[model samples]
Each structure stands twice: as C-alpha cells, then as structure tokens.
Target: MVDYQIKIENCNSIDCADILIKKGSLNIKYGPNGLGKSTIARAIVSQARNDGSLELLAPFKGRGKAGAGQPKVSGIDGIASALVFDEGYVNQFAFQQDEVVKNSFDIFIKTAEYEKTMLEIEALFAGIKKAFSDNVEIEQTTKDLKELRDAFGKTNADGSIAKSSKLLKAYGSGNKIENIPEVLKPFESFIKSQDPSKWIGWQIKGNEFLKLGDTCPYCSTALPDGPQKDIPLAVAKEYDANAIAHLNTLKAVIERLGKYFSPKGQENLEKITKAKLELTAPEKSFLSGLKTDIEALIAMLEGLRTISFYSLRDVDEIADKIRLLKIDLGMTEKLDSVETRKVTEPINAQLEELIKQVGALKGSINKHKAKIKKAIEENQDSINSFLKSAGYKYSVVIIPEPDSYKMKLLHKDLAGHIDSASKHLSYGEKNAFALVLFMHQVLSDNPDIIVLDDPISSFDKNKKFAILHELFRGKASLRDRTTLMLTHDIEPAIDVIKSKASAFQGASPSATFLSSKGGIVTEVQIKPDEIHTFAKICTEILSAPGDTLIKSIYLRRYFEIMDNVGLAYNLLASLFKKRANPTVQSATESRDMTGSEKSQAVAEIKKHIAEFDYDALVNTVSDDNAMKAKFFATEVGYEKIQLFRIIRGKHEDDVISKFINESYHIENEYVMQLNPHKFEGVPEYVVDECSRLLKTA
Candidate 1:
C-alpha cells in the first residue's frame, strides 16, 4: 500500500491539515463534533471533480479579500475520482420519487462488461442505420408522414373529430367555405382569386358597420333598398378568416404531398376539399383509415432506422418489426418524384439485412445477459436485506427498462410501489438508506478513493454497527478499498478498529484523532490500547499530576460507577455543593460528618489518589476565588467544566446549574470517550457558557 499525505490549507475551520492516508485501506478520522471533518470531505470532493467550487471553502476570516488566502488541496493527484457520502450527498441523491436513489440503474447494473456488449450490438446494427442515412429521401419521407398524420388529429380513429384537429377546424360540417351566393356574384373574380381570405376578412369588417343605420356606415351613402340589406346577410354567411386560412394551408400541403398517396387516398382527400357542403360519414371514415396507415408506416420506418440492442431483445419480435417496414409497392408507383423510389428501395434492402442479423445480435446480448441479471438481482437483494436487518420495512426492486433498469422502493404496509420515498422515510432512515446505497455505488464505480463524512453518527449503537458491517465486512462490500470515514462519534472507530476488528478481516482499518486549535488542524494515531473505559480513564487521570478539585471530581465519578455512593460519594458530592465537612438532615435528625466518617472517606479516596486529603480537597473546592482563577487559567474544556462546577456551587441559576449537572455525569458506562491528550474533548460552547455565568457572578 502507498501512503499519501493530503495537505489542506485555508479551508473552512482548517488552516492547515497534513493528513496521511494509505491507499487500499479504511482510514478513519475520529474527533469531537467541531473539528472540520465535513469541510475536508467537501474540499477533497470539489478538487477531485475539478468543479471550481473549492474557492467557496476559504475560511470566513479570509473571505472578501483579494488574494488573501486561497484554499488549496495538495497530494491528491493520484485520486482521479472519489465518491463521498456526506449530508449534502444524502439530501441530493437519496429518497427520490419512485426510487430510493436517483440513478440506481447505473449503480446496480451497467458494468464495464455490459457496456462493451452493448457497443458490439450497436456495431451490428450499423448497416441498417447507414442505409437510412445514405438515402437523401429519408428527410422528406418523414415530413410527408407528419403532414398526413396531422390531418387526422391525435388518435387517427373513425369518430367525431376533435375540436383541436387541424382538419376538423378547417373543413368540418360548418367550418368549410362553399360556393358564392348569387347576390355576391358581381365580385366572383375577387372571391375566386388565389388569396381571398384577407379580402373576405375586410368585407366582413365592413358588414359589421351596416348595423348602425339604413344609410351606408362606411361612405355615408343612402342604402334604403332591400338588395343592399341582403349583402350583409350573405357576407356574414361565409367562413371566418382563420378557418379559411387553415383550409388554404391544408390544400397547399396536400398539393405537395398527394403524389405519395394511393389513388383512393388522393381521391378521397380531393373530394373532401372540393365538395360544396359537409363531408359524408363514409368520407370521414376513409380519411381516418388512411391516417392509421400513414402513422404505421412512419413508426416502422423510424423504428428500423435506429435499431440497437434494446430493440433486438426478442429475436422473433424484432424480425417481425423489421419485415413490417416494407410498404405496399403500389403506394410508391403513384409517386413521380425520384425521392420516393430512393427511399423505398433501400428500406426493402435493409429489411433483409436486419432480419438476417437478428440471430447474431441475440447471441451477443445473451452472452452478457446472465451477468447483468445477476448484478441486478444481487443489488436488489442486498439493499432489501439491509433494510430488513436495520428495522426498516421498505424494500427495493430493480425493474427492467428498455435500455437500463429502475429500482423502485416498496413498503410492506403500503400498496404497490411508493412514488414518494422522501415523504415516507424519516430523516435517519433517509440517511441510513443513502449510506448503504452509496457503498454499493462505490463498489460499482471502483473509484480511487471513497469518503464517508460522519455518515453513521446519527444512528443508535445497534444500527450504527449494522450499517458498518454492511459497508465494510461483506463479500461485495467496500472492504479493501481506500475509504476515509470521518466521524465525531467514537463508536464506529471502537467497533471497526477494536471491538469487531476480527469481523472485518480485509478492511485494513485504522484511526486517528483529529483536533483543531487556532484554525490549524492536526491528527494523532489512536492505538487500540489507548481507547479505555471511563473508569480506567478516571483512574489514570487521578494518578497523574493535576488540580486537587479535578481529582476529587474524578473520584466522585469513580465512586458513582463503583456503586460506593454511601459515605465517600456523598461527602465528595457535599464538597462539590460548596460545603466542607457536610451534614445530612432528614425527617429524623441533623448531624455533621464526625471525625471517623471523614477519616473513612479520606482513606477510600487515598486508595485512588495516594496524597488525597479530605480537608485539603474540600478547602480547594470551597474557595470560589481560587476555583474561578483556575477556570480562567485552564484551556482544556473538561477542566474548565470541572472548575466551573466548583465555582458555581449551589447557585440559584437553574440554567447554568443544569448544564453543570449534565456535563458532570455524561461519562457513563457504555460511552467510549476519547482521552483529551492535549486536545479538548468537550465543546467550546459548553465551556463558554460556564465562563459567562461565572463572570457575571
């Protein structure tokens, strides 16, 4: 394995972080909550994709400055591509409608082998594609097909015409223009001209003014006769300008494309346009049937021109489809244009070529079908199994598409498939499912590096370990890849590197504690031996050099853990409440701790701290001035918390008192807390709250 040092500078909270990551290993960066782990994940991803968003990571102190500090990531040249599972990735890709993940087909199916087989099949169909391209008539043939298809409306069926049909709007029962009336025969030349729709519109506009009076509304001439009144009624009886314009457009299209139609089709169309009245029912049926024929021809031609592996999935079916492209020879015979013969001749030849090649195409596709099928089934089963084991009632099924596959999410209580997974899934469920899917995606892509930034910290211990095992400890998992898992919770590191190390044999897991100070981040290797129980940690600290009050705090915790809460625990707790040699008062009697009780507690405390003196520890915590001085002088967050606890003894402020109580008792039996070796384990905000409360006092 090669070790690479990744140096990041001036990015977010990290000023400089020189981290060593080993290729082909699972490297975990473990730290407390605010050590810039997510920022590092984003920075590395930004550089790997070369998306130019790395400048957005410049630290807030250096923002809006010209050339002040440029965020840079070095030593990642070997990482050509990386898949990171972060909060942003989860929100963007997981819990999509109709599927658990947005491009599930690419992650679960389409391997390098599948793509290669598809390319071979495409090459086999190249002959048919080239024939269509070489013939220059194919473009016009498509246009001719579209022109006839538009004349019959959407369904191309024998029924009442749709209101939106171009043919219906132009030449329906009341829409068409018939012969001119005898009253307007004087202007027959203008009415029968090449363009009469505009002139008809002008005449109709002039007729509207005749309603004003018996006199002429336009030129102020007298019109008291009956014949002039009949002029307005005749003008209003004609078709509107839009209907006339549509009729003109239809006639022009038919004139250019009619030669391609059969004799019966051309005759029926001419009679419809030339008739002086509405068409008969038989005539409408003829046009609808003709429309169906034209639509089928267009579909056949277009389908054959672009054959691929998806088209030839079933050999017999595609062979039938290709043979159907051969139209009747009589249709071509009526056309005088050379383009018709050019198109029909090559189509017949390619029909033969396509029918002959179907067997070979089927063989090529079948060669890879087993592998692709297995991949799809395994992916579906893997995700569903994860959901089951992790207490999620949802499952995924990979449905096949024409050229790919789709993975749809299903719920046990819901009907059919869920179309909106994001709505049904909780926030944690979404995050968990996204993490597992991301692991599968990393396996599919086989990128150089995989980064999981604080992925499983949101889960409980049971689910956290379940997800970790699924991600790094299976046959088809990210076991030996170069993976970086950054987390604030120590559970993953404890489980992967220590508790369950044998479970993940090939993972090559290792961890480092990340800590930041003054915008500079650093890491220290956390050996398995360094992770200890809280009781052992308390003992280790009590044995070292430190303040007496801090040692008493650890002693109190040890007594609580050891169940020795009778004399020693209560006495130390009383001292913590700012009382020295405390008294116990109940409904019965009030009494001070006698010399014998003090000696007994002192003796028990000295077992852990050899120099422990009861009076000295009590006196150290009782003096508020000395404890406040220690709180200001100390930089360690845990120490600050303890000193604040001593300084704010029995104060009536419930908020600060509650915070101190929780912080004091947070280290329980099950928690795997890191030793604060030169770094603060508690958050700065907790210590700041303590400092703020004390300063007011």
Candidate 2:
C-alpha cells in the first residue's frame, strides 16, 4: 500500500516541527508525551473518516472526548485537514485484570444458567397463577349460570288451564260449540271422580233436537206458514231451557273450582314470583360480575398475548365459563372439545417440564463451574504453546464457578498440581495473560485493525519494548493489516524506526509550546526568500530622501528651461514661481502700463513662454550651471517678442502651424516613451491640444 503523510501548519504549539508521517509496518513516532505527536496520529485517523484538514487529536481516556485542536493535513487523498479525533481511538482489544479476569469464566457460566432458570421459573409461576385464577373464576361462573337458569323457570307467572277453563264456562253456550263434547272428554275424565251433578248443566248435544226443530218449543206454537221453517219447536225449547241452566251450572261450577284451585294457584304463583325475584337479583349480579370478570379476563388474556408465552390462564377460564353458560342455556350440544377444560392437563405437564429444564440448567451451570477450571488447566499446555510463538509463555487457566470464574496463571512446571501462588500475578502480568486470551479469541474472527492504548504502561523499559516488538513483529500478528500502538515512551518508537520500520513522530515538544500561543495559518506563502526580497526592497526605497529629488530638479532649473523653450510652456509656468531677477524686475517697470496692464502683460508673457520651443531652448542653453538664470530671462523676452510680432505682423496661421507641428512631435514622443518625466515632459492635456491643432491643420 502507498504510504500517507500528514502536514500541519500553525496548528498548536508546533513552532519547530510540522509532522510528516509514513505508513507501513512498525511505524514509529518519536516525541515527548505532551507534544501533539499523539494528536497528529489521531488526526490522520480522523481525516480518514471525514473531510478537510487534520486537527490536533485530543487525548480522551474513552470514546467521544475531544483531544487537540484542528491540525492541517496534506498528501492523503480525499482526506482534508479539518477532521480530528478529540478522543483517542476506541481500543478494540480490551483486557480485564485482577478480580474481573479471575472470576470471569464462572460469572459467564453462572449468569447464563441463572438467566435460563429465571425465564423458566417465571413462566411456570405465571402458568400456575393463571390456572388457579381460572379455576376460581370457572367455579363461580358455573354457580351463577345455574342460579340464573333456575330463575328462568320460576319467573313464568301465567295461570294454569283451570283458570282459562273457568272463564270459558262463565260465557255459557258461547264457549260450547257442537264439538265441545269431544273437546271436553279429557276434562270430563279429569273431573270424572267428582259428581256429574256438581258439574251442573254440563251436557252433550244429541240429534233428536234437530229432528223436531221446526216450531218454537217454549210457546208450543206452530211453525210460520212459509216454505222455510225459521225454527224447530222442540229444539228451540231445549236450547232455551238448557242455555239458562247451563250458564247457571257453569257459573256455579266455575265458582266452586276457583275456590278449590285458587289457593294452589296462588301458592304456585308465589313460588314462581319468589323464585323469579330471587333469581332476578342474583342473575343480574351474576351477569354483572361475569361481565366484569370477563372484561378482566379479556384484559389479562390480551396482556398475556403480548408476553412471550402464547398460553393464557384467563382464556381457559373464559372458555370454561362459556361452556357452563352453554349447559345452563340447554345449549351443551354446541360446546366443543376446544371450548371445555381440556387444556389444563397439557399446560400443567408443559409447565412441569419447563421447571425441570430450569433445574437442569442450574445443575449444569454448577457442574460446568468445576469442569471449566479443569478444562482451562488442561488447555494451558495448548495456550502456552500458542503464546510461546508470540514471545510470551505462561499457562493461563479460566475456571467456571457459580457466580464468577477464577483465573489462574501457572508456569509449565506447575503441571497437575493447583498452585495457590500462581493465581497472584502482578497487574501487568495479568493484563498480558488477558490480552493473550482476547487476541486468541479475536484472531479466530478476521479483523481489519487492532488498536492498543498504553497497554505496556506498568512494564519496565525492556519488557515494554519486548512486548511492543512482539506485538508488531510476531508471526501471529497482523502482517498486512493495521496495528495502532499508543504510548508515551520514545524508546520503543525509536527502536521500531531503527529496525527500519515505517514511522512517524507525534507529540513534538514544540507542538504543545506553540499551540499554547494562538496561531493561524494564512493563505499567503511567506517564504524565507520572499521575505528577504521584500525587506531589501523596503530598505532601498526608504534610503533616498524625498526632498533630494525635488531639490535636483529645482537646482538644475529643468522645468524653467523646458517652459522657456516649449510652445506649451504654460504647463510648467502654471506649476512653479519664477525666481525674482534684478534685470527682469527693471525691464518689467520700463513697460508703460498700469497695474492691471502690467498684470495682463505678465500673464501674456507667461502664456507665450508656455508655448516656447522646449527642445530648441534646451539645446541653446548648453551651460548647465547658468541654465536656470538664462532660461528665465530668455523665456520672458521671447514671450514679449512673440506677442509684439503677433500684434504687428499678418503671419498668424504660419506661426501657429509651426508651433502646433513641434507640439505634436513632442506629444507623440511622450506617448512612445515608457516613463516620461512629468514636469520637464510634455503634459498629456497640452499634447492632446497640439495633436488636435495638427489634425485640424
């Protein structure tokens, strides 16, 4: 794999060394503990996970703590400088020492067994409780249903057939149709033992009455003299007498029968009424209780359904209640096997078995406790063989117990005898043994990386170095995979590097010192060469005084001379005051002019001087020492001469054209020059005007 390097600038106290890390076997970093050497390593790891520059890796004892500030990282593809792990990386290979390791195997076995037992026992208790509750509920429900059904029988209060028969008899012949004789046969037998006379006018109808029913028998009158006989005399006589006697007798018999059966009917009605009344309250009470019970049962069942176990005791109770209700309602035929008390046996049997299994697991755990110690002892030879290749050779045994396991360390010589002193290894030695066990377990499953944090803390220099070497170089160790070792010592790191292992320094002393003072990384590259160049430039610029350049021009009279000769001399004349000259002062007074005329003349003189031929004037004034005095005098005189000539002569166009052409050449020359001197040079405004005049010409 390609090696990756980290570069950080102005991050922390790192005034001296910005880091460069290399990747590969036995990678070493040599730095003091407080420096950001560790920070840099963490930063690389952080950058691998995220974006931007690497930040100072903060040291955290555990996960999620911030370690160092942000560090700038470079060279790693797709990794920016901003990412950092404040906390040291999570140590994937963890080892327990002292008591925890001593009792681990026993604890493991016991905890597992206890958990199994608890689950089974809890399930059994729940089932037993449910069965008890269901049985109670079913018994109560059956009793209530039976009472309610019995009440149903009592509450029927309608009178018997005797009362109905009495009412019919009171209505006399209206109640007696021709078929009454056949209908009354059963009644006749019911009352056969009683006197027929006591039954009064009760009689069977005969055909003899119909045979002689042509006349009204009571009056003994002949039938009406018509084709149809309205009535038969004998039948009418019999019907009339019998109807009166029959009504009287039926009324008497009904009255007698009512007296006899009335008490019994009342007694029976009262029994029914009392039964109904008794049943009504209890039935309602039972139903209300049942509803409440059922609702409670349903709630319980619903709760139980949500639990791990599928069976519910309340459901069984409900089923039993339903069966009882079915029997009470004469619907027992509708009750099925599934709806009865069939499940109790199977559920009880399963619960018993579950309890037995829980007991068995507890026994197994106890048995394993002793066996695990023996097993670990037996396996010690194999473990030592494995550790021997990894540079350490101590027999470590883990014995399972009820609460926790006991860990024992022994040399090969201890053999079959249990050595009490062997269990008392130092903290570091215990840690080593635990580490071996952990590594053995972990290496069984393939892993990509192994991170160790201060694992050799308690060991001496030699031992620490030895362990470090073995961890990194051992045959069983990861060859191609990454192994991150975190430590405060530089010896192991230097040793690794001297052995030609790939190494990067972390935690430089300067890093912490510089980071204490706030520093920032800017975008600008402030190189040593660039700084030197900038300083030299500044010194040269500052060396020359500003006044010297100004004095050079004034002492030489460069501007004054250029003005006297150039046509556009007004440009320079406007800028500088001419020196007061004795000859020129006297010459100015000779002009016969008022104060205003003198001012105008001086202004006109200056204007003409501004337009003087600069190049021609410069060539004429060859002596450098007397140039300023000569140029000023000549410029004033030349302006007077030009003004006088212009006023007197008629050659204005020719003179103006000659001045414009000269000005054009000077202006053109200025444009071609890279850096034209300003005061001694043609002004851009004057040059533009001269160009315009030339173009117009």
Candidate 3:
C-alpha cells in the first residue's frame, strides 16, 4: 500500500514550521472554500516533483527532482507521487481553460507537428539508406558476373581443335572430313610431293596467258594447241592420284601416333594440329584473323579475371563500410556472424511486426477515409459516443492517414469553420483533454505509474463529483498500485476520510490535516463532530434503507445533543428508551368491561394512549394510587406490586422495612436466595430502605 501525506509552509496563508501528516494510507483535509485548499494541493505536487519525495505519495519514484520542503527522508526512497487534481487546478497548471472543449484532433495536430517532422525525417533516411545499400550490392554483383561471362565466349572459334573439324572437307569426294588429322596430314604430304620446279613455268601478262607447253614431267604428255588443255588435264590427274595415295599414308601415321601417345601428349598434339590447320587457310587470311581473335580473347579473359579480383575487393570494402555505418547508426555492433545474428534477428522480427502493423493500419485508414462521409451520416451515434468521452461533442472527424494521422474539427454550422483549436472549451477542459491524451500515450507505452496535474478543473460540480467518485470506486482497478489525488474539495475530502473509518475498520489508516493560523502551520486533528457528520452522510448514502427523512432526523438529534450533553449521553439515553418501552401491545379486551358503555370508555382511553397521545397518560390516570399500583406491577411483576403499595406515601425507611420483612420471609416459598453483596455489609432494614427509595423516586 502507498502512504500519502502533505506538508506546507511559507505559501499563501501557510508559513513557518512544517506540519507532519499522519502516516495513513489515505489522508484528507476539509475546510470551507477559499481557504487555500487548492494552493496546498499545488504545493504538494510541486514539492513531490522537485524534492523527489513523491515516492511517499504514490506508486514509485520516476526520473525527476523534488520541490522545496519535501526533503529526502530515511527509509522511503522508492515512493513516487501520483497526483490527480480538479479542473481549476488543471487549468491553472496545464493548459488554458478556454481550449478544453476544442476538438481533440486539432490539438493533436498542433502538438504533434514537431514530433511528426522528426519521425518522418528519420524514417525517410532509414528507408533511403537501406534501399541504396541493397541496390548497390545487387548492382555490383551483376556487373562483376557480366564482366566474367563476356571474357569467356560461347566457344573457341579461332581455328582451335574444336573449330578445325567443323571447317574441314574430304578431298575429291566433296564430303565433310570425318577424321581431321588424317585429311590434314595427307594433304601436307601431297603438297610436298608435287614439286613446282618439275613442271614448265609460265606467266600471264595483261589479258593474254603465256604457258610453257610441257607439263610433261609428271604425265609425259605433249602440249595441245591454243590453251594446251589436254596436256595440263593429264598432268593434274596423275598428280592428284599420287597426292591421294600419300595423304592416305600420312593419315595412317597420324592415327597410329594418336593411339600410341599419352593423354597429356595427345592434348599437346591436338593443340599443335589445330594451330597447323589454322595456318592452311586460303591466303592464310582467316587463320591469321582467328589467331588474332584468340589472342584478343585470351588477353581480355586475363583482364577480366584481374578486374574481377578488384571488384571482389571493392564489394568487400563496400560491405565493410555498410557494417561500420550500421554500427554508427546503432543498427549493429560488429560485422561478425554472431553480431549480425544478434542485431539482425531482433531487427528482422521488429521489421516483420512493423510491416504487419503498417499493412493493417494502412488498410484501416484507407477504409475509414473512404467512408468518412457515410460514417458521419450513418454512424453519428458511434462517433458521438467516442467524441463525448474524448470531450468533443461538436463537429469533428478523426481521420487516420497512411503515413500520418489527422483529426479535423469543424464548426460547419457557423458562417465559417474554425480550422485551428481556438474555439469553445475552457482551460479546465483543455487540461482534462491533455491529461486524457497523456494517459492514452502512457497506456500505449504501458507505464506503471500515471502522474497527473489537476485534471478536472473545467467540469461542472456534478462532473467533478462524478469523476472523483468514479476514481475512488475504481481504486481496485484504477489504483492497482497507488494513487495520489490532490484536491481542494473539502466535501470530497471529508467523504474520503469518513469512508476510511469503515474502509479500514479493522486497521485504521493514519490521517493528518494541516492549517495555517497566524503565520504558523498547525496540524489539526479531525474532530469527532466532523467524523460524525461524515459517518452520517456515508451511512445514509451507502447503508441499506437509505432514507432522507431518517437521515435528517438523526442529524438533527445529533447536532442538538452535541450542543448540550455529549453524543455519548444521547446515545445511552436513546438505547435505554428503546429497551424499556413496549414495542407491541395486547389486543385482548378485559372481562370487567362487559357492558357496552363501560367497554367503550375503556377502549377510548386505550385508543388515545396507543395513538401516542402522551397527554392521555395524565388524563386516563384519574386515580394516582391505582395508576402507581398498575405501573409498579407492569414494571417489576405482580409480586413487587404489594411492596410498592406498602412504600406508598410513607416514610421511605419504615415502608422499606415492612416490605423487606414480608418479601424476604425465609419460610416464604417465593423467597429464594438473596444477594449477599446487596444485604451483607448493611442491615436488612437499610437494604430495604434503599430499595424503597429507588421505587419511590
């Protein structure tokens, strides 16, 4: 439980020595209005906040300093202050009263402007930087891969072993060469066997052809007339035949070498063969071009590989830079896998949740925005309920946007709507709204304590009372931990104090009231009268059969007794009267009143007394002796009636002696044990005499 107390000095009517409040779980101060009650509440709040002693008042201490006069006391360092104030106090301390009834949405807009600006900038930077980093990584990877692929073409096409077979053809058969090594070797041998020096040589000048006629060295043919077609044809045929035979032999040799060579040797031989075939192209133009192309491709591949190394280094550097940036931004602590795991795991989780929230909120905002007009027309009741609770009953719309939220309050009925929050409500209401919004914010964060200034100033008396009552009733729920309410309302304070009497019935709480008189602070104990008044009010309000008439009568009698005898005497007298009086009467009629006229007279007398006509006590009792006899018999029974008769109108001592002699007859069956304490120390006659005096008086 929390222990709340207040002390004041040197402010308003209070000054000098500090008044120590009693250590009650609850304490209340009651006084007439304008006695600086609110002032004390404010002072206590200020002191609790500044001096850091508010922990004594409520849930627990927070981060802040305490005000003056609330010093750090022993054994109470964890106490925090929770003060809820009335509308007037709220207005004076929190916000202007005139703004209370203004639209909550507008107020939120005006206040959230700066906060929105900062958050938006932060979110934007975060989003942009993350996107840029991700894009850079992707782009760098793509560029490096493209460079690698470009350096390595689809296939080797520079007359290498792979391309030679694709270009070769069979000699004289007009068929593609199936065995490239055999064909190439045979053709080389044929070229060597057909020596150009053995044949006649000729030259062509201009359009005329000059040829030596012989061509006879290989075929032994004479030259023909004109172009000598026959002689050249014969020599070409014989030479082709010889070339074919030599090519066949060369093919056999190459095949044998291929079979005999080791795998490594064969690979080298294939490379040499490809190079040789590339050199056999017409004019050697294609071969030379292919060689250049292959060389270029090789050089380009080397350059690309080198560039790939630099690119990898650059990627690593960029990644390192990002890691450092993360640490600088407090996003991560290190580039190690463990650190990455520690940092990214939570962030990823949070990011997922944020995405979910953003999605939901976006959808909701869109839906709500779309139905704004329809909601205003069809869901006015729902809107009104929310508005009333939020302290806005006029024209207002709460619109939640995608990136930001908005609230609009309009006075459409007026000539022009007020766009700003400068209309309607008083200062107290504004403070109350601010307090409500603050509470909402705190609830969103789920804090343990709710510290507030006066939050009820702008309300009317009924509202003030209602709010206080609700707060007190909700003590179990609303005050799960502790609540410190500072107020100047004496009535409510008194109510709380009186309630404490029963609330803490088995264990009473401590209570203290401090008042300033003649510049000195004095602690005034709540008087019994004040306590009774509170008790009376509570009993009337909370007790069963809560009747105003009964309460009024009780109060009237209570005050009357207070002015005369003490309340104790009044209580005792009332108890005696209730116990002594007969609550019910017999309905049976007496046998002596048989005649109609006699019965009627007796009945009339009975009726008047039964009706509580006290005058009838004297009127009906015309004979004093008979009335006394009857009164004595009814009081002490029939046996005591005889004693009363003997004591009537006689000297009290003599009458008492005669009654004792007869009443205490030892032989009398009716007489049982006598009280030794009543008659032992005194003579029998004295005891009897004292009894007779009690009867007569």
After aligning candidate 3 to the native by TM-score, how far in Å is the CA of 312 from where it should be? Answer: 37
Model 2 regions more than 4 Å off: 7-24, 32-34, 44-394, 400-466, 473-475, 486-697
TM-scores of the models, in the order given: 0.88, 0.27, 0.30
Residue-level lDDT of model 1, residues 340-367, one tens digit each, is 5566677677668767886776677677
The C-alpha RMSD of each candidate to the native structure, in angstroms, is 3.8, 34.9, 35.5
Error of 2 at 261 (Å): 53
CA lDDT, every model vs. true structure: 0.76, 0.36, 0.36
What is the lDDT, from 0 to 100, of the residue 193 in candidate 1? 65
- Model 3 poorest 10 in a row by lDDT: 670-679
Residue 273 lDDT (model 2): 25
Off by over 4 Å in 1: 64-67, 154-165, 172-208, 213-226, 229-235, 314-341, 444-447, 584-594, 632-635, 650-660, 667-670, 688-697
- In model 2, state the lDDT of residue 13: 43
Error of 1 at 190 (Å): 7.9
TM-score, structure 2 vs. true: 0.27
Which has the better TM-score: candidate 1, or candidate 3? Answer: 1
The lDDT, on a scale of 0 to 1, for candidate 1 is: 0.76
